[model samples]
Target: MNENLQSSIEFSHESGFDPFMESEFHDSLKKKNPDIVINLISSGLHKSSEKYAEIFADIGSSFINATHTSIAINESFIKTFKDKKLIV
Candidate 1:
């Protein structure tokens, strides 16, 4: 009984419950706490990604995006982030 199956699905920021607006969030984070640590859990997104790179770039955040549709860690990116002093 897929009553509303005909209804369309749209792509928009509001589609997901991501509360952080990226820019504003980073600005506030900087003003509110200077030494705060951000541990981003991501997948397939990087500094070159159009969808999430902007958010990651903000607040100097680092991440570990992965592949294979599993929760496995992206060791390379993680190591790089740690090496760059972005995360511990």
Candidate 2:
């Protein structure tokens, strides 16, 4: 390959693992790196998180509350539970 062509190709390949462009991860690129992500996470939860926490906390909160449910599936166990009970 010509030197210019090789250099161009290499340059195009140089931006690696940009989490902003990739939505497959649960957390942002900053969040993936604890040092940087913590800043984005905030010392206190965001308004939406706080609102939801308040709504749910009145009922209950637990890490294992929905361990068996699939968050991605439509009509998942979580959806069914939510439909069945206002608090669930």
Which candidate wins on lDDT?
A: 1
Model 1 C-alpha lDDT per residue in residues 26-85, reported as the tens digit of each score: 544445433333334344544424233234434455433333332124465455455556
Where model 2 places Cα greater than 4 Å from the true spot, the runs are: 1-45, 63-88
User: For each candidate, what TM-score against the reference?
Assistant: 0.31, 0.20
Q: For model 1, give the 10-residue run with minimal summed lDDT.
A: 1-10
Residue pairs in candidate 2 whose N, alpha carbon or C atoms collide under 3 angstroms: 30-37
Provide the lowest-lDDT 10-residue window in model 2.
Answer: 32-41
CA-lDDT, candidates in order: 0.40, 0.31
Residue 7 local lDDT, model 1? 26
Off by over 4 Å in 1: 1-19, 38-58, 61-72
- lDDT agreement of model 2 with the native: 0.31
